[model samples]
Target chain A: MPRQVRLRRHPVGALAADDFHVVDVPMPEPRDGEVLVRNTWTSVDPAIRIRLAAVAPAGYFPAFGLDAPMDGIMAVGEVVESLAVGFESGDTVWHTYGWRDYAAVPAGAGALGALGSLRRLDTAVAPAHAYLGPLGPMGLTAYAGLFDVAELCAGDVVWVSAAAGAVGSLAAQFAKLRGHTVIGSAGSDDKVAFVLGELGLDAAFNYKRGAIEDQLRAAAPDGIDVYFDNVGGDHLRAALSVLRRWGRVAICGAVSQYERDRPAPGPDNLFQAVANDLTLRGFRGSSYTDRMDDMQRDVAAWLRAGVLRHRETVVEGLEQAPEALVRMLAGGTIGKTLVHIA
Target chain B: MPRQVRLRRHPVGALAADDFHVVDVPMPEPRDGEVLVRNTWTSVDPAIRIRLAAVAPAGYFPAFGLDAPMDGIMAVGEVVESLAVGFESGDTVWHTYGWRDYAAVPAGAGALGALGSLRRLDTAVAPAHAYLGPLGPMGLTAYAGLFDVAELCAGDVVWVSAAAGAVGSLAAQFAKLRGHTVIGSAGSDDKVAFVLGELGLDAAFNYKRGAIEDQLRAAAPDGIDVYFDNVGGDHLRAALSVLRRWGRVAICGAVSQYERDRPAPGPDNLFQAVANDLTLRGFRGSSYTDRMDDMQRDVAAWLRAGVLRHRETVVEGLEQAPEALVRMLAGGTIGKTLVHIA
Candidate 1:
C-alpha cells in the first residue's frame, strides 16, 4: 500500500490541512510507457502558496482542480515497477508528483530534467537536497536570467530583491563571479548580513527596516545596471528608479504579492524604463529546458571549483510536507526549503 | 538671420508659453566637418513633454545649454554649406536638430538616410506624417516590441492598449500582417471604431465606457497571447488578467500615467505574469538601433506594396509645436504629430 495526498477540495485562501487528504492505496502495476517512483524527497516553494489560493493558476504550471493531485517541481525515488520503455527497476528519478509515497508518471513529466539531475545524486559536490537548490532549477534560473536575458557583463552593478532566497542567493554569487558589483535586499538584518558577509555581496540592505527607495539609494549610489527581481511591487519600482541607462531587469518571481487575496499593485516606475532605455523581462525555467545539460555541467563545475555554495532547510517525513510549505510561505525558511521523505 | 526657440526655464508641469522663447540670431557657419542646414520639418513626440519639465545642464542635448534650443528628430533642407568629406552642398538630408529656422550640424551626424532612393514618401500607404509615426521609430517600436522583445509569432492573438496612439496603432497593423488576431482598446468610441473598421482590428473596445477587464474578456474570448502596452495603470491590469499562460507583453509606453505628478498605482495583475510564465518587457528604440536598417527596408517595402498604413497629424508650423504637444498630451491626437518649420 502507498500513502497518497489527494486534493480533496480546492482552497479559497490559505490552504488548510483539510484541503488535502492522506489516503492509502493498493500498489498497482505500471502500465505500458509508465514507471512507478517511490517518492524520496519533495521541494517546497513560494509558488505553492498561490496554487492553494484557488483564484487562478499563477506561475509556471496549470491551475489545480478540486479532488485531484497537485503536482509541481519535485524529486523522487527508484522505479520499483516500470512498464516504460527506458526506465528500469531500482533506477532513481525525479518527476512532478503530488505529495505522495509513490507515483506512476509518464516519461515526460514536470520540468524534472530541467530542474536538476535525476539519474545520479552527487553528495560530494553538492548534497542531494542541494540538487533541488543551487544545483537545481534555482541556480539555473539565476544563471539564465543573468547571462541569457539580462546580458550581464563585467563592471556592471547589479541589485537583487529577496536576496537571501533560493534563486537570489545563487544569483548574487553568480553575478559576483562575473566581476559585477552586487548588492542585495532581504527582510532581516541577519539575512542581509549573510548575503554581504558570507555570500561576499558587495553590499546588502534590510528592506524591512526602511523605504526600498532610500535603501536602494544608499546601496547603489551610482545606480544599477542589472536588477534580478524575485520580490515585485515596491521593490520593482525601486529597481526601476535606480536603473542606469540600458539597464536590464529579470523578473523570475514576485513572492511579495502571491499570498494576497487580490493582486499586488504593480511597480509605478515603468515610464522610467523607456526614458532610461531599460529592459524588464519575466522568465520561466521551462523556456530554457533544452539548455539543462549545459547549465548543469557548468554549475557542477562551479560547485567543484568552490565558486558557488547553497544553504537548505530540510523538513523530515512526508507528513511534514504541509508544515514545510507553510513555513516557506511565511518566509520562515532561508535559502531552499525541502522535505526529506525516507 | 536664423530664428530659433530656446528653453527659457524648466517647466513645472504642463509646458507653458513662458517656458520657451523664440530668438533670432545670425546663422552659424559650417565648421570643418560640418554642414549648414536650412530647417524644413521636425517631429513632436510625447517624450519631449517630460524633457520640458526640468532644466539640467545636459539633459536633452549636451550642446543645448541654458537658454539654448531643444533638439529632436528633424527633416532638414539642403546642405547649404558642407565641410565634411562625404557630403555635398545641395544634398537634401535629415538630422536631429533644434527648433530653429537654420542650423549647423556635423556632416557625419549619423542621420537616417534613404537607401539608394528606397525612401520615397507615400501618402496612400500611410498618412504623410507617418514618416515619423509608424514609418519612423513609432512603427519600429511596435515591430520590435511585438516580434523582437515579445517574440510574437504568427497565429498569436494580440491585445493593444491606446490602440489609436502612435505606437499601438502600428503594432495592431504589424501583428495583423503577420497573421495574428488583433484586439485593441481606445479611449474614444471613434478611435475604437477606427481600429476595427479602418485598421481592421479583429475586435476593438472603448476603454472609457466599459470596465477594462470586462471589455478585454469580451474582445479576447480565447485569451490574449501578446499585450502591446501603451497605457499602463488600469489598462495594464486588465491586460494582465486576460493574458494566457506563457503570454508575452511588450512595454512600449505608458500614456495613461504620463502626465501624473506621482507614479500611478501598480498593476494588480503583474503577479499573473510570474504565475502564467508570461514575458513582460520594456524596450527603447535606441536599443534596437542595429535593427533599424532591416526594419526600415521592410517597412518601406510593406508601404510600397500597400500591405501597411499609418496616420499623421500635421500642426503646420514650428510655432504650433507647443499646441501639438498639448494635444498629444491631452489624448486628442490619433497619430504621429509633425511640425513643418520651413
Candidate 2:
C-alpha cells in the first residue's frame, strides 16, 4: 500500500492541518507509457492555497475536489517500475505528483503533468531535492521575473519582499550577482539575518520590526528602481511609495494574504503607477518556458562559481505534508518547505 | 487688464466654486522670443483635480499653491503680439495657459514646460473650440489607450466606463470603427441612451440602475477582451471579474473617486491579473506625443467620413471655469466641459 494526502474540507480562513487527511491506498500500477515513482521529496508551496477554496477562484489554478487526493507543484522520486520509453527502472525523476508516497504517471510528465515527461535527475551536480527547490520552478520564477519581466539593468537598486523565502532569496542573489544593489525584507530577525549574512544582500530588514515604508526609506535612502513583490498588502503599498519614477514592479505572489477568507484590499497607491509612469506587471513562472534554458545555464553557472546558494526546510514523511504547508503559509519555515517521503 | 482664475485654497474634498477667485491683472507684454495671446477657450479636465490637493499625490502632476494663478491643460487663443519666429500676430494658437484672458509665454515652450510653445491652430477642418475638445488630449487619450495600451484588435469585445464622457465616448467610437463590439457604462439613463443610440455601442447600461457586475455580465455575456477604464472603484472591480483571459485594461482615469479626501481602496480583485494573464497599464496622454501626427490624420479622416462625432458642454467666461470643473467632476456634464473665454 501507498500513502497520500487528501483534502478533508475546503479551508475557510487560515489553513489548518485538519483540512488535510493522510490516507493509505493500494499502490498504483504503471500502465503502458507510464512509470511508477517512489517519491523521495514533495514540495509545499503557498500558491496552492488558492485552489483549496470551496469554489476555486475563477480562472486561477484548478481546485482540488473534496475527499480527493490533492496534486501539488513538485516531487522528486525514483522510478521503481517503467513501462515507458526514455525512462528506466531505478532512474531518479522529478514531476508534479506530489503529497504522495508513490505515483504511476505518464513518463512525459513535466511541471503539472504525469511522470512520462519526468526530468531525469543528475545527482553529480546537485542533490535530487535541489530540483524541487533552487534548481526548479522556484529558481526559474526568480530568474524570469528579474531578468525577463523587470528587465533588471546593471547598477539598478532592487527591493525584494519575502527575501528569505524560496523565490525572493534567489531573486535577491541574482540581482546582487548581476551588479545591482539588493535590499530585502523578511518576516523575522533570523530570516533578515539569513538574507543579509548568507544571501549577502546589500541591506535587509525585518518587516515585523516597523513600518515597511519607514524601514525601506532608511535602508535605501535613494528610492528603488525595481520592486520584486511577493508579499502583498502593506508591503506592496510600501514598495509603491518608494519606487522611483519609471520604476517597475514584478508582482510575483501575495503570500501574506493568500490564506485569508476574503481578498485583501489592494495597494491604495496603485494609482501611483500613473503618476510615476511605473509598470506593475504580474506574471507566473509557467509563462516563461522559453527562458528556462537560459535560466538553467546562468543559475547553474552561478552555483558552480559559488555566487549563488540554495536553501530548503525539510520535514519527514507524507503525513507531515499538511503541517509543512500550514507552517509555510504561517511564515514558520524559511526558504523552500519540502516533505521527505522516503 | 487680463482676468485669470487663481486658487483660493486647496480643495479638501469635492470642489466648490469659492475655491477659485477671478482676479484682474495688468496686461502683459511679450519679451523677445515670447508671444502674447488673448484666450478664447479653456478646457476643464478632471485630471487637473489632482493638482488641487493640498499635498500633491507624489510623482503626479504638480500641486497648485494657494492664491497662485492656476494653469490648465488646453486653451485656444489668437496671438495678439509675437516677437518669436513662426508665430505671427492674429494667428490662432493652442496652449496650456488656460483659465485666463491673456498671457505672454516663451515661443519655444513644449509640453510640461512654460506656455511659450503654443501650437498653431488650423481651423480649416473644424472650429477652434474643437481643438480643445475632440482633437485635443482627450481624443488622443482615447486613441492611444485603445490602440497603443490596450492593443485593441478587430472583432474584440470592448467595455468602456464613463462611456458618455469625452474620452470614453471617443474610445467607444474608435473601437466600433475598428469592427469591434463595444459595450459601455454611464452614470445616468440619458447618458446610457446617448452611448447606445448616439455612440452606437453594441450594448449600454446605466451603472446606477443595478450592480455593475450584473449589468456587465448581461451586456457582455461571453466576456470582454479589452477594458477602457475611466471610472475606477467598483467599475474596475466589475471589469476585472468579467475580463477574459489575456484581456488588457487601459487605465486612463479614475474620475469617480479622484476628489475624495481619503484615498479609496483599490480594486479587491487586482490579483486576477496573475490568473487571467491580464495586463493593466496606466498612461497619460502626454506620453504619446509621437502618435499625435497619426492621431490627427486618422481622427480628421474619421471626422470627414462621418465615422466620428464629437460633443462639448460650453460655459461662457473664465470665472465659470471652477464651476465647469466641479460639474465635470460631479458627472453633471455629458462630454468635454470648456469655458468659452474672450
Candidate 3:
C-alpha cells in the first residue's frame, strides 16, 4: 500500500495541515502506454494555493475538490515499470504528478500535459531535486519575464522583488549576465545577505526594514527601467513611483496577497501609467513555451559556467507537503521549497 | 492691441475664473517667416489642466508660470499678414495657440510645434470650429486609441467612458463604423440620451445612477473585449471585472481623479490582469502623428456623409476661456468646449 495526501477542506486565509488528510491506498499499476513512477522529489509552489480555494476565479486554474487526491505542478521520479515506447525501467523522469508514493503516467504526459512534454532527467548534470527547482518552471518564468515580457536590455536598471526566491534569484542573475544593473529585495537580513553576497546582485535590501520607496531610491539613485514584480502591494506601488519615463513592469506574481482572505487595494498611483508612459504587463510561464528549448540550453550553459546557482529547501516525507506549502507562502523560505518523498 | 489670458495663480482642486486674468498687449509685427492671425476659435481641453499646476509632475508637460500668457492646443484663425511661402493674408490657418484674441506665429510652426506641422483649415467640408473639434486631435485620438492602442476588431464589444465628450463621442462613432458593438457612460441622463439617441450607441448608462459594476455587467452581459478608459476610478475597476480573457484597455484619461487634491486609489481587482490576461496600455494623441492624414481624410468623408456629427459648447469672449475650461472640467459641457474670441 502507498500513501497519498487528499484535500479534506478548502483553506480560508492561511493554510493549516488539517486541511489535508493522508490516506493509504493500493499502489497504482501502469496500463497500456503508461509507466509507473516512484516520485523522489515534489515541488511546493505558491501558485498551487490558488487552486485550493472552493471555487477558483473564472479563467484561472481549476480548483481542487474535497476528499480527492490533490495534485500540483512538478515531480521528479524514476520509472519502475515501463509500458511506453520511449521510456525504460529505472529511467529518471519529471512529470506533473505529486503528493503520492507512486504515479502511473501515460507515455509523454509531461508536466501533466500543462508544460507540453515530459522531460528525462540527466543526473550527471545535477541532482534529481534540481529539476524541481531551478530547471523547472521557476527558471523558465525568470527567463520569459526578463527577456520576453520586460524586454530587458543592456544598461537597464532592473529591480526584482522577492529577490531571494526561486524565480527572482534567476532573474537577477540573468539580468546581471546581460550587463544590466540589478537591485533586489528580500524579507529578512539573511536573505538579503544571500541576494547581495551569494547572488552577487549590485544592491539588495530588506523590504521589512523601512519604506520600500526609500530603499528603492537609495538602491537605484536615479530610477529603475524594468521592474520584475513578484511581491505585489507596497512593492508595486514603490516601483510605480520610482519608475522612469517609459518604464516597463513584468507582473510575475503577487505572492504577498495570495493567502489573504481579501486582496489588498491596488497602488494609488496607477494613474502614473498615463503620466509617465509606463507599461505594466502580466504573463505566465505557460504562454512562453515557444522559447523553452532555447532558454533551457542557455540556462544549462550558464549553470555549468558558474554564472547561475540553484538553491532548494527540502523537507522530508509525503505528509509534510502541506506544511512546506504553508511555510513557503509565509515568506520564510529563501529559495524553492520542496518535499523529498522516495 | 491683442487681448490675451494669463495665469494669475495655479489652480488648487477644481479650476476657477479667479485663477486667470485678461490683459491687452500691443500687437506684434510679423518677423521673417512669421504670420499674424486673428483668432476666431480656441479649444479648451482637459489635458491643459495638467500644465496649470505650479509644478507639473516630472516627465509630463511643463507647467504654466504665473502672469505668463496661457496657451492651449488648437486655435482656428485667418492669417491677416504672411511673410512666408505657401500662405496668403486671408488663408484660414489652424495652429496650437489659444486663449488669445490674436497670435503672431511662424508660418510653418503648426499647433505651436506640439502637433507636428501647422495645418491650414479647409472650410469646404464644415465650419471653422469643426477643425478644433472632430477634425483635430479629438478625432485622431479616437482613431488611434481604437485601431492602434486597443486593437479593436470588427466583432469586438467596446466600452467608452466619458462617451459624450469630444474624444469619447468620436470613439463611439468610429467603433460603430468598424462594425463593433459600443457601450458608453456619461454623468447625466441628457448626456446618456445623447449617447444613445444621437451617437446611436448599443448601450448607454449614467454612472451616477447605479453601481458601475452592476451597470457594466447589465450592459455587457457576456463580457467586454476592449475598454477605452477616460474615467479611471470605479469605472476602470468595473471594466476590469468584466473584461474577458485577452481583453485590452487603452487608458486615455482619469478625468474623475484629475481635479482631486490626491488621486483616488486604483482598481482593487487589478490582480485580475493576471487571471484574465488583460493588457492595459496608456497613450497620448501626440504619439500618433503618422496616422493624422488618414484620420483627417476619413473623418472629413464621414462628416460629409452625415455619418459623423460635431458638437460644441461655445462660450463667448477672451475673458471667458477660463470659464469654459471650468465648465468642461466640471462635466457640465457636452462635446468640445471652446471660446469664440473674434
Candidate 4:
C-alpha cells in the first residue's frame, strides 16, 4: 500500500494542518505508456494555499475537492516499473502527482501550465531533490522573471520581496550576479540577515519592523528599476511608490493574500504606476517553460561553481507534508520547504 | 487687463461650477526672449480633477494651489507680441498657460512633463481648437497608450473604456482603424450609440446599464486581448476577468477614481493579471512627447481625410471652463470638452 495527502476541507482565514490528512491507498500499477514513480521529495509552496480555497481565482487552477487526492504538486521520484517506451526502470524522474508515495504518470505529458513535465532528472547536474527547487521550476521562475519578464537591464536597481525564500533568494542572487544593485526584504530579521550575509544582496530589510515604503526607499534611495513581487498588498503598494520611471514589477505570488479567508483589495496607490510610467506584470514559472533549458544551463553552472547558493528546510516523513505547508505559508520555513520521504 | 479662472477651493466629491472664480488681472507683457499670446481655446480634461485634490498622487504633477491660475492647462492661442526670435507676433501658438485671456511664455522651455511647451500651431491641419482636441494632447495620449504602452498587436480584440470621451474615443478609433475587433464602453446609451454608429466599433455597451463584467463578457464573447483603461475601479476588475492570455492593459487614466473625495482600493482580482500572464502599464501621454511628430502626422492626415471623426462639447466662454470640467468629469460631455474664448 502507498499513501497520499488529501484535502480534508477548505481552509478558513489562515491555513491549518487540519485542512489536510494523509490516507493509505492501493499501490498504483503502470498501465500502457505509463510509469510507476516512487516519490522521494515533495515541494511545499505558497501557491498550494490558493488551491485550498473553496473557489480558486478564475482562469487559474481549479480548487481541490474535499476528501480527494491533491494533484498538480511538484515531486522528484524514482521509477520502479515502466510501460512507456522512453522511460526505463530505475531512472530518477520528476512528476506532478506530488504528496503521494506512489504515482502512475503518463509518458511525455505535461501539466500545471507546462511546468510539471514527466522527464528524467540529470543527477550529473545536481541531486534529485534539487529539481524541486533551484534547478527546476524555482530556478526557471527566478531566471525568466528577471531576464525575460522584468527585462532586467544594465545598471538596474532591483528589489526582491520574500528575499530569503526559495524563488526570491535566487532572483536576488541573480540580480547581484548581473552586477546590478539588489535589495532584499524578508519577514524576519534572521531571514533578512541571511539575505544580506549568505545571499550577498546589497541591502536587506525585515518588513516586520516598519513601513515597507520607508524601508524600500532607504534601500534604493534613487529608486528601484525592477521589483520581483512574491508578496502582494502593501508590498506592491510600496513597490509602486519606490519604483523609478519605466520600472517593471514581476508579480510571482501574493503570499500576503493567499491564506486569508477573503480576498483583499489591491493597492490604492496603483495610480502611482501611471504617475511613474511603471509596468506591473503577473506571471507563473509555468508560463515561461520555453526558457527552462536556458535557466537550467545558467543556474546549474552557478550552483556547481558555488556562485548561486541553495538552501532547504526539509520536513521528514510523508505524513508531515501538511505541517510543512502550514509552516511554510506562515513564513516559519526559510528557503524551499520540502518533505523527504524515507 | 486680462481675465483668468482661479481655483477658489479644492473640489470635494463631484466638482462644481462654484469651485472656481473668474478674476481680472494685469495683462501679461512679453519680456526678452518671451512671447505674449492672446489665449483662445482651452482644454478640459479628467486629470485636472486629480490635481484639484489637496495632493496629487505621488511622482505626478503637483496639486493645483487654491486661488491660483492653473498654468499647466493646454490651450491654443494667437501670439500678439513676440520678443523670441523663432516666433512672430501673429503666430498661431499652442501653449500651457490656459484658462486666461493673455499669457507671456518662454520661447522653447517646457513644463509639466514636457507637455506644456510653448510652440506654434499649424492651423492647416484643421482649426486652432482642433489643436486643443484631436491634434493635441488628446491624440498623443491615445496613440502612445495603444502602440507604445499597451503594445497592441495584430488580431488583438480591443476594449476601450470611456470610449465616447476625449482620449478614449481616439483610442477606440485608432484600434478600429487597425482592423482589430473593437469594443467600446461608455456611461450612457447615447454615448454607446455614438461609439457603435459614429466611431464604427464592433461592439458598444453602456457600462451603467448592467454589471460591467456581464456587459464586457457579452460584448467580447471569447476574451479581449488588449484593454485601454480610461475608467478604473470596477471597469478594471471587469477587464481582468475578461482578458485572455498575454493580454495587456494601458492604464491611461482612472476617471472613476479622480473625482471621488476618498481614495478607492483597486481591483480585488488583479491577481488575474498573473494567472493570465497579463501586463498592466501605467503612463501619462506627456511622457511620450518624443512621439509628437509621428502622432501629428498620422492624426492630422486622418482629420483631413475625414477618417478620424472629432467631436466637441464647447463651453461658450472662459468663465464656463470650470463648469466644463465638472460636466466632463461627470460624463456629461461627449468627445472633447473645450472653452472657446471670444
**Candidate number with greatest lDDT:** 4
Tens-digit lDDT track for model 4 on B188-276? 99999899999999999998899999999999999999999999999999999999999999999999998777879999998998889
Candidate 2 CAPRI category: medium
Q: Report the candidate with higher lDDT, 2 versus 4.
A: 4
A1-342 in candidate 1: lDDT tens per residue? 677666676665466666676777777456777788887887877766666655555344666566666666566576788877777887766677747788777764344334533344546665566667776677778888888767898788999887888889988888887778999999888788789877899899988899998989898898989999988888998888888877888888888777666766676667676666677777776566666667778789888888776877888877777777767666677787888888
Docking category of candidate 1: acceptable
Least well predicted 10-residue stretch by lDDT in candidate 1 chain A = A109-118
Predicted model with the maximum TM-score: 4
> What ranking emerges by TM-score with the best candidate at the front?
4, 2, 3, 1
Candidate number that wins on lDDT, 1 or 3: 3
lDDT per residue for candidate 4 within A161-270, as digits (tens), equals 99999999999999998899999999998999899999999999999899999999998999999999999999999999899999999999899998676779999988
Model 2 regions more than 4 Å off:
A108-117, B113-116
DockQ values, each candidate:
0.41, 0.61, 0.58, 0.83
Q: How does each model score on TM-score?
A: 0.83, 0.95, 0.91, 0.98
- What lDDT does each candidate get? 0.73, 0.85, 0.84, 0.91
Better of 1 and 3 by DockQ: 3
Reference-based lDDT, residue A184, model 1 = 91
Error of 3 at B139 (Å): 2.1
Worst 10 residues of 3 chain B by lDDT: B109-118
lDDT of 2 at A299: 79
User: What is each candidate's fraction of native interface contacts (fnat)?
Assistant: 0.57, 0.47, 0.55, 0.82
Per-residue lDDT, model 4, residue A22, is: 84
Ranking by DockQ: 4, 2, 3, 1
